[model samples]
Target: MSLTGHLAASLHDRGLGGDQASAARALRAVHRAMAELRRGTPVLIRGGDHTLIIAAAETVSARGLSELGLAGIGPAVLLLAPVRAAAVLQRPVPQDAPGTEAGAVALRLPPALLDPAVLRSLADPTAERLLPAEPERVGAPALASAAIALAKLARLLPALVAAPAAEAASGRLDLLSVEAGHIAAYPDTAAGTLTRVAEARVPLEDAPEARLVAFRAADGGIEHLAILVGQPEQALAEGSVPLARIHSECFTGDLLGSLRCDCGPQLRGAIKRMAEDPSGGVLLYLAQEGRGIGLVNKLRAYALQDQGLDTLDANRALGYGADERNFWVAAEMLRAVGIGRVRLLTNNPDKLAGLAACGIGVEGREAHQFAANGVNDAYLQTKARRFGHLLT
Candidate 1:
């Protein structure tokens, strides 16, 4: 591989060539590796994709292998092959190995190469297995808020990128021709010049970094968002500190007292912990509403729930994958928050591996399980028993 922009072009400009069923099949295959972390790659060869496996790294020493579990790399380590590869990815190949130089890694086929029972296994020794998940509902109200939030983004992202920079700083936005000037906010940084266009005041956490940047979308809608930052002492750590949290966005529960799905409770718990001394931690407070089914779908799922369906069944009936949410967004959010390492706060082992695949270190995990109550018993049980969550 000459690094001739092959992989980048494969992923970026060129989209997949397949029908709906093929696309779904591709995704479902990746979903299969939710059990043990497998290693492989998505080959863009020929008409169909294939997963090729690497065996050299899998032959790691016992000492190195022991670190795999105790490292607390979070959940999906066993399930997500890409994440598993990173968890066990070694650098500077052993000097004792023959013929190969140091750092010559043994790579594998991607999970997309799901078949291994036939001759293809000889060509690429890779396999796939299913892991599971059980996500609770974000309720009707939260979904509505999330819809509005996403809609606002859909309308404003273009203009905000084109708006004059002066307006961004002054909170007074001015539209200019896209060709003339562009005012794009750094995606990695949320603390740019914020103009109070809508006069919406976002309340804050006790810390100085706890101010939500409120602004008017180009659509003339008022929006407020709060960011929690660690203090100077915690912000600048010598080594990576592992951190994790079950961040349920605070549309109603975290802000208003809605006993819907413990979003409020979890948000409080995450903030309290994040406010502590900064150690590389994993806090995945995602913007995924109703686990990415969106507000309308979430409400629809709720309707099914009211009709005597379990939480998982309700989502399935509503044409969702039980967990429609993708953790990649959470991974990006964590990186934006200056989190490089983390001790994930979750019970779903899959989530751990997902974050690790996305490049966040998992030192350990702190289980976030709510006390059993009749109202949430079904939801909790599905998570612990069905979804493979480490509830106990």
Candidate 2:
């Protein structure tokens, strides 16, 4: 197959293409736009009847805003992470307002007041400002564009965009063009080259027989760790469906014992449980910190949680989905180790779905849960309620 044909096939597998050819074109367009946003460059986003030029609010400049305004794009509004919005706006957000969905709040500021200082301040994660007395016109497409831009820039999911327009506008804005080759190359580049970098005997407090194996991607994007307990390779060799747990990395709870979530206990507990099993198990430690939004945004979500938002709400407020992880890497790691099937251990149905979608067979599920602590009670409840995580 040609390079274009291969790219289209991959995009189709990812559900981002209509067909191989069209998918290749779409991938090129979206990939170029995403790359532009990552570099703090403004890009044009159009959907439905709206077209807007947007950049990541975290890095967007007064000059950038001025450029968009000169091109008839602004008085700029910010589509903020829910917690950031609440802090910056200095008021309780109304439940019925537009841009309130997914813990996101859009505030349109006066173009006249948007001096360089103010624009720079908006870029700070900790900075706060008063919202305008009256609402700014934020339509759905603008919100979507902001979401998409932020997702690419921050590695968050469910992208959205925000503009300074007080009302919806119609027209085609030809600001940039992308080639199919560029689009086809992104997925290939992002998939990276996965290679096992290290392996060693790592006796854990709970699982003394554990072995740690590390796999690094060529892009240095994320490194996946496999914690093998009780000879999983031997068990699989004997045709036993070894147990498996796919855990996303959590810096706060896993490392700091943050009571806001149950990640640490789950990590330790999974190892302990596998230690008792004669057949053993594998725990794939993914580098998808904060559900693929990275650690900084997780802290931003923590701030929103302090404002009484639930976990899902906090993520949404930050312009991310409830969960943004994809399990293809887990499947690949499993395949690399010569494992074909397993009894998956998880509370998240999405994990099972993700692995299955990536062609890994889950023969059964071992329900895993930890008793909720005082700080994480609401967090656990939110997971079960909003994200459909199975818990008792």
Candidate 3:
């Protein structure tokens, strides 16, 4: 019951080839795929750069998707955005049509998905509104809405290119825009109607501290990440400048200390370190469980792992490859606290890569490993070997 089994089970439930399959099975397939990526379960995609995957995902609409078939359109529509990039020529796409890259990226959608109606629902405004919202939302209408959203984003890309300069000029959050190249505001920072810049960093005492404290993410979900702060001011220059234990939500390891993984100790260790450090680091416990995949699907992957699937195989078995987490909110928390450079504490190199790419720097990275036990040895080895963790 590796990830593939999970997916086959899900497809079985879809009535795609089912009389015995259940809808929950399909949901788990979607779940494992997303969480695998988010949690840094490593695997390569189509031999291209990771940004291509991210760029495609970014270009798609994030709203309203229940059916795996309907939501699958996002990645499909997203593949077009990177073609305009200069690097795309450096890494030319294969002889595939626009949406085909998305299909190749996430091979869940049928090849018939190349239909113009699917493309139109994604692009046509009227069809987008007509996109089925409830029961009828699974097929063409969902694809239609994705098509429209992607088209809208594409239309807005040029303007979006200039949005950073405008956003930083008028943020009340304690964020500094020193580097001209990366001056975008925090993803959660309020925009619109205001266009003023901060002269300098505003901390406690003379100036007011924004309520960034209230945004802590404490949860019982699947993925877990921790943000430890040795020095906050070096990274960002925002109001209240929060140091955080940024954990992705994980259901099994964090709560149950599942031997299949070591997420629990890392999370607790993050809290302990943050609490001890005294830099006022906020533990932003995330609700994006199983890397936003939810609980049941993780169990499904476990079942697959028992069936001798490697991590990536587990996800692919479930019908997805690795990685699906977004760091906008994590970036926001850093911005809210006025941190410019961070002394990040983690073993995962991709976290460093992703955060740095998103505009945060690892001025330093420290490794964190909980006590090793009999249960999670293979799991830790898998994470360390395949995903590139700095094992201790």
Candidate 4:
């Protein structure tokens, strides 16, 4: 039988649906591959008619690169997102360029650029001094694009060192193998598998009556939190839309009280507002640090900010989108807790539209603006001007 038919038959033998089970298995493989990538270990990606061994450019060491080279048949290559490739090559790569996602600019890696430091400089735009090299742009294997995607999922820089794998390298080298198609399908597949796993009454300073619900995907990845304050479920039961806020977790701002942005104030202030509201509210604290580029990359962006690049531009320069937080996870969490309609507490118009697109009924919006401290005035202005936040 065909691959699809075989997968369906195996899932049926285990009493599971074909699509969901296949996606779950694929997500688990991708999850393990991400861990391997983060630890600087090379992973073998198997696509149709091709096999490649790839390592994260951010974490891979000289030893790891050498070992990857030893195991692979062809010359090693560096795969970079178009934006980052542009920065490294000092050329223009239009965002609207066709085939951007389908392929990446593969720079043939020379012996001098194989060091960890040089690889990092090529991946990171905020590097102090980029090493000079004659980079030849070539169309990388289709799997190279997915390899970069895997690095992004690991919260690393969207750059990877890849080489064509030796024959039967998966068995000979004992490398973790992941399908490129699975890496491509990871986001939606993981989001679709988000289930409310655990919850408890976690009282907060502002919201005394609060319960924290945790949602985890089937692959056992990061959990998104739902802070139900002042009986939001009850409000939903009574046909009153609860106040809702989708807060992306900011490590520096929320925990360390860093004044780089208004995240701490917004997080605390949103809870207080919900507690005071008679209709109650739910706060979805998504584990999307640095607007989904992860914490370390966020620090890199902070370094870029010191050089006068705004928040959005810094992220783009780092080969990431302006905001990579997926609100589909938020919508799934809300649905699990029986909340389909909400009066969202946010200044960003994107939140309103994001929920609406995910089939969540946004009854209205409540402004949850916080006054800018002296340090965050310019940052707040960037939010309003560049991110189109509705700040008054």
Candidate 5:
């Protein structure tokens, strides 16, 4: 079978088929739409029961808008962060306002402003904004699905904006079709069936006895790493449960030493702790940045955080659930390395639950915590309060 066909079959086996297929498909479409929007291309988004051409307000061009017949139909509505929304709309959006709960607001602009120059400003990436001018009436469930998809893409709260289905299908505007269901299945299956593509000894500043092993997904969507400290293989060979830490990749915090979260400390702390342990450990370095929202969206959430929203609320305001990460990849990595059980290191209970769900035995959890600084105090508090993270 071709690689695509093999991936499709694998996805189908991972519970993305049958009744759940629509939701999966919708998610894939959202991802595709996000990619297209990033390139300043408009995409056909099916929301409610209507299909609408949607693009990021920062990148949408006057020509792109005209191609979708948006200018001829009517004015476009801009969805944006409440602070920016209030600033742009020149109206006060009460904190207690109904839709303001998501920290986002939408404003309908005059159709006259759909020109290229105006659109370039509207689609500014630094400016938190979204344009939804056209709408086709669809069912509430469908609209909700589309909203969630859009939120995941923009990493902001959900907003209402879409192009008409008929206009989208007219072939003038470039429409990227999404096989969302198939794509959604890729992650789960990939986690279970990752192939080790490369491995090499890479000494870190603290953990000099570390070796990095890379695993590629069958569908080629994502890659995960297993950083072995000490002789994890030898430990496992002797029937010992190797210590392990499933650390999600954090560019801002891990790379830049940002104190907004405890990720950096936890990462280094885990490696240091493992280096000291006689059994050593394996740090499954996951590429699930920003709890799986990706780097740019995480920054968008940071902007929302600056506006007084907690970590969880910031993600929700951007149309995401509290945690979008999965631990199947970590579980699969452990299994691949011949370790069935582990002394998992983490403060989050979800990690335990996720690993357990994936059939990995968690022998025990080593309490992992870093001293709270002023910047991360609120963040730590929210993790404890909202997500039930084990932090004291």
Candidate 6:
């Protein structure tokens, strides 16, 4: 069935009405659009007064590029986040615009650069070849910026091939359509849609009496977990704040015991500390692997790191921010578990601010640094120097 068909059936089953149905439809469209972009297909993004069709530069196929060229609206352009544009153009671009961290860039997508492999090289810094041509820079419209944002959401490189959408061509192409506004609002909207779905008693080696509560979005997206050790919520009722840790899932480090980072120790140690606390605590295990850039992009960043770039710069080289995580979801999970105030266990100050911004009152910070394994010493140092993590 089509994505729209699935959404329509879901809405009908749930009997959603009015604004709820409208919001659900918008979320469904964005979700479907992400899936389409990942598979090398195009989607149309409609803004307040304009519309554009965009495809991921890293994944757009030859046929997709042909469709953009033949749209009969205007010449297709390449849109990249400002950091990436600087890397590709080998010069600094403007960063004065609001909400455009260092500003984004739009380059005219010439016919020569339309081949899938060529476009992939342009989007991925890890590619060996130089760009085929010196593309001219053009002003990026709002929808163009949205296009890059959509690529990032799809867990592809934050680069897009886009063109103005002709009404007739948009209809004829039968492309999935979503709103730029909805793309911007997706993280918080999806966070708001979460509800506690299930709970089970699963004692851990570090945290005996651990109960895992799973939170799922209405659309059945990835689930965030709350590992409750003892009585954190009970402490809240007794007017005492409990300990909390916001841990983004690290599959390599946490699961495979990769030595390039300290995630495994931090994760296990946090649980032990929370288990020992008389007040007890809750650990919000988020599914934001590689700080929310997704596992594949994280591995790409690691490849860049092997070439001597630090963690932060490695992420930038791949056209992502220093961190792409949305702590709003963590805040929502904490709120659901009746944890409004907490003594947070973390080394990164961003977690403190992130929770506070989302109305989660952080009582204080409990230092949680572990000794660096010989392999990850530089990685830990990079965290302290570049990301301002409190390692001491």
lDDT of 5 by residue, 1-392 (tens): 32234334443466534444454454455456666666656666443354545555545665566655642244345455444444344455565565443434445556665565565455333353434434222222223234334545444333334333463463644477443333345456446557799999999888889999999764445689999999977997798877999898999888999989999899999999999898999999998889877887788789878988788867755545577666767878888877788889989877876676667788898999888989899999999998888988
Error of 5 at 178 (Å): 1.5
Angstrom error at residue 352, model 1: 0.7
lDDT of 4 at 339: 90
Please report, in order, the local distance difference test score of every candidate based on alpha carbons: 0.36, 0.64, 0.38, 0.82, 0.65, 0.82
Supply candidate 2's per-residue lDDT for 184: 33
Query: What tens digits encode model 4's per-residue C-alpha lDDT throughout 222-333?
Result: 8999999998888888878889999999999999999999999999999999999999999999998998899999999999999998898888788886787777788889
Q: Which digits, one per residue and each the tens of the lDDT, describe model 2 over residues 285-375?
A: 9888887777887897788778777777677655555565556668778887767788999998777766765677899899999998887
- Which parts of model 4 have CA positions greater than 4 angstroms off? 1-20, 95-103
Instruction: Give the number of the best model, judged by TM-score.
Output: 6
Candidate 3 lDDT tens digits, 336-378: 5555556566787666655565465556676787766987788
lDDT-better candidate, 1 vs 4? 4
Candidate 2, 16: how far from true, in Å? 12
Ranking by lDDT: 4, 6, 5, 2, 3, 1
Candidate 6 local lDDT, 1-392, one digit each (tens): 32233233333433223376676786788889999999998888898878788888899998888777666377777788887876776776667643243336787776787889988988888877556446577767667777777788788999888777786667787788888878877776677777999999999998887999999876567899999998999988998889999999999999999999999999999999988998899999998989889999999999999998889888888888788887778888999988899999999988887777677889999999999889999999999998889997
Alpha-carbon TM-score of each model against the true structure: 0.44, 0.70, 0.46, 0.90, 0.73, 0.91
Worst 10 residues of 4 by lDDT: 1-10
lDDT of 1 by residue, 1-392 (tens): 11123222322433223544443333332222211112221101011121111111222233323332232112111111111212223222242333221212123223332223321222111222221122111111111112112212221100000000121221221111111001111111121222244222233353333433233222222232324445322543665464556454545555666555656656666655655635523344455466555554456556656767666656544323445344444555555555666767677777776666556666788766667555666667777775677878
Global lDDT of model 1: 0.36
3 against 6, candidate with superior TM-score: 6
Pairs of residues at least 3 apart in sequence or in different chains that clash in candidate 4: none
Query: What ranking of all candidate models by TM-score puts the best one first?
Result: 6, 4, 5, 2, 3, 1
